[model samples]
Target: MQPTFQNIQEAAQRIAPLIHRTPVLSSESVNHISGAQLFFKCENFQKAGAFKMRGAANAVLSLSDEEAARGVATHSSGNHGQALAKAAQSRGIKAYIVMPETAPSVKKKAVAGYGAEIIMCKPTLQAREDTLAEVVKRTGAEFIHPYNDERVICGQGTAAMELIEDTTALDIVMAPVGGGGLLSGTAITTHAMLPQAQVIAGEPQGADDAYRSLQAGKILPSESPNTIADGLLTSLGTKTFPIIQELVSEIITVSDEEIMAALRLIWERMKIIIEPSCAVPLAAVLQQKEKFAGKKIGIILTGGNVDLEALLSKF
Candidate 1:
């Protein structure tokens, strides 16, 4: 079954102790820069250094004792791997993480540090799936999909839930769209709780399949996405696509240059380190200044897992 508002509520309660209720922060400088009153739902401060922890914890905890005893497995670029590993460690179960060989070393090391066994595969969707299938088949581990599961969607929605609860009368809520998990959850929460608020999504121009999919009125798979925001490289999931098409108000695409500018601005002005994927929404806001001007907006700053050397080399 698809996740519901009640599921999100339950997820909040279920993962409460397991995750931090990350802060909602605002920067006066950023507000002036974007021409909006921005409330950043700082999930970058979350456990596992990303909002993926909420979904990973909920998915692991929702399993039956017998199912959990078999352990869990998934293919991730980074954050979800770390999150699943952390959750499994906390539950005293093994986790098998299948990761792309191209994924940042920082993230790979972090996943390893969490005690999950890492299986590296060629950096393609097919290779990751094939590798994960072998691991799960061999170990009898339950597959917990990164973003396509109902429990995960519900858990991801809690970030937006907390954002709305902490702020009042938001005109719009925004998040980056990749596999559409966070955006789907954000749209669901905003639609149910702050019905008046519009939920917008930002996509990198280099990987604008979500934007194209919405325009095409169907799920268009992401092919060879090349963006500095490595976290937003996946295609939209079946479950996440329906929610996004129905509840999300709009999607805006921005260039890598715009994303880098927004990233630098946030780093310089807010004095916080955020991954490039986390900068997409803020980039959209800055790019479309007229639409967001003077509006109260909430943006989810998704993660902080950046490889300094790799990122610097990109420039």
Candidate 2:
């Protein structure tokens, strides 16, 4: 069944004990920098070190024992892979993660630490899907898409549910869009809880497919997404795109340099480590501070999964 508000609510209740109710942080310095009263939902501190844990837990837990016995499988190079591995571990089920060979070794280690099997593939999306299919065929495991499935979407929405519940009177709420799961889930939850709040999405200019998709009234895949935000490279999913098209008020694009600036600013001002993907919304807001000035806004810090040593090379 396609996820609805009730599904999101149910997902929250189901995963409450399984996942962390990560803190909503704030910084007067960051607020001053962006010219907005910013509430940062620190999902970087979540179980499995990303908000993906919420959705992954819900999906795994929602499966019946018979189905779970067959386990679950998905293709993700970063946080989703780790989240699914952790979720499967909690449920005592096998998880097969199809990762690109080029994916960071740290992420692979994290997924392995959760006891999920790793299946490497070529870096292309097609290669990842093909590899995942073979894993499912051999294991008879249920396929759990990283961002496209309804259960996953509903699970992702819980972060926004927490954000809106924790912070009052938010004028706007924005999340970074990759496959649109988090952004769409956020829009669904935010609109349902705070109808007055505007929902925005941030996209990397290198992978501005979501913005183009919204304008075109259709899902448009990015031919090649080249950005430092490795997590935000995939185009929107079939299930998630419609929700984003209908609910998102604006899709803002930010450059890699702008994302880097935001990344440094947050680390310096808030003393929190966030990945480039997590910094997209803040970068978009800061890029157009005049539009967001004086507004009470919420930004979802999606994850902190990154190679700090490699990241430092950029500076």
Candidate 3:
């Protein structure tokens, strides 16, 4: 069940009233600097404060009555956990969210505010997985993977669908790549609907697995990521990697400093608070300004879950 434009269309219909049709913003400053027309999909303004809500809601809805009765479980760094919790609660279903202890307090509080059970683990992917597995086994909860599942990808694809619908004829579309879910989904939708448009991925240099994997034509695992973009830490998943390889045009890498600079630009110029992971695409534009000159580019501002105080202290 590979996610396609058709699946995304259906997902749009399914999650329309449940999720916000996040605004598409034009940035004059970004346009002037890059010499390109820039349209930003403001998913930071989305419900649950990120685009994860669309996928999470769609995945939860796709479950059968029996499965929903059994409840759902997933592990996330932050945004997806809150999304899943809210979505599950909408259907009167229990959600068990296993999150790393290193996850931001805001996200943990958001999940708890949604009345979902939160299980904290050590700050490692393996630890989160292990804890989530135990919770699933004990509670008989159906596992809802954050990014590796088709339904989730289909839901994610809807973001590009909305963007394309709002502003047609983009030369290139760029989004930050982490687990490759959003990038893969964006690729699938854009490749199908706007075949001429190039779909590129923006990745952190600190976690350059996606960039290396795309170049080598294979999935490369991340070796202990240490990036400021916390959301861009995961290695590409099996399902997302194949789709990305097929549909994505390229993967570009940016430094942590570049990411931070982009974050500052967004906050200072656009008056938006986007996470470092979401800033990677904008960083790519700034890094490769010559390549994008005079082109129409679409950037996905994927999330806005940054810790303001922590971010300010970094300055």
Candidate 4:
């Protein structure tokens, strides 16, 4: 089913009790540095340490008793795996999470700590898909795709809804686009609640499939993306592309250097630790400060599951 504003409302109701209503924050230092009034939706403080919990909770709850008993499965390199695990555990059901063997050890441990069975696969998307298929077959588990499912999209939309609810007159709403799930949902929700607000997507130049797909008018898979923003490496899915095409106004691309700069700025100014992917949107705005000067720009702080010790060691 195609996701809509109504579906997003339903998802909000379903997940209200299940997930945190993450705060929308701003920093005077960041505002001065960027020349834009930025309201950050801090999903790092969310359950499972990411916004994925909202989608995972809604998807798991939407299943039937029989389906719930059969359990749930998904493939994720990080936050989403932990999210699905938390959701399944909440219901006393099993969650099978497929992760690329190259995935960060911190994320792997997080998923396991949530009580999900971890299945390791090769780093490729094909490898994850193939392995997930086998696991689903073996366990009869209902597959809850990380971002492509309608229920998941609906749940994701609620984040934008909350942002809009908290601050009613946003000039622009932005988020990092990977599979296009969060951005597409944000587009739909922003258009629904505040039609005047423009929805933009931030994309890493190293993983620029979303920008290419938007330009080509078709989905273009990224075979190999080399970037620090690991969460934004996935290709846009069929389900998410159409919604993004319909609702999103534009996509802005940023280099890895720009992303890192934005990451450091936010960490220092806002006193928050967000991942590289989460910094993409802020980076896009900072690079285009002239365009966004004094505008109320709302950006999604997508996740915060970083290898902090290693990251801090670099600088």
Q: What TM-score would candidate 1 get against the native?
A: 0.99
TM-score of model 3 (CA atoms): 0.98
Better of 2 and 4 by lDDT: 2
Tens-digit lDDT string for candidate 2 (46-68) = 98889999999999999999999
TM-scores of the candidates are: 0.99, 0.99, 0.98, 0.98
Please provide, for model 3 over 263-282, each residue's C-alpha lDDT reduced to its tens digit, 9 standing for 90 to 100.
88888889988998999998
Which of candidates 1 and 3 reaches a greater TM-score?
Answer: 1
Largest lDDT belongs to which candidate?
1
**Predicted structure 3: clash tally:** 0
Clashing pairs in 1: none
Candidate 1 vs 4: which has more TM-score: 1
Off by over 4 Å in 4: none
Cα RMSD of predicted structure 3: 0.9
Cα error, candidate 3, residue 140 (Å): 1.1
What TM-score should be assigned to candidate 2?
Answer: 0.99
Better of 2 and 3 by TM-score: 2
Question: What range of 10 consecutive residues in model 2 has the weakest lDDT sum?
Answer: 1-10
Estimate, for each residue in 1-315, the C-alpha lDDT of model 1 and write its tens digit. 668899999999999989999999999999988889999999999999999999999999999999999999999999999999999999999999999998899999999999999999999999999999999999999999999999899899999999999998899999999999899989989999999999999999999999999999999999999999899999999999999999999999999999999999999999998999999999999999999999999999999999999888876
Candidate 3: Cα lDDT at 136: 91
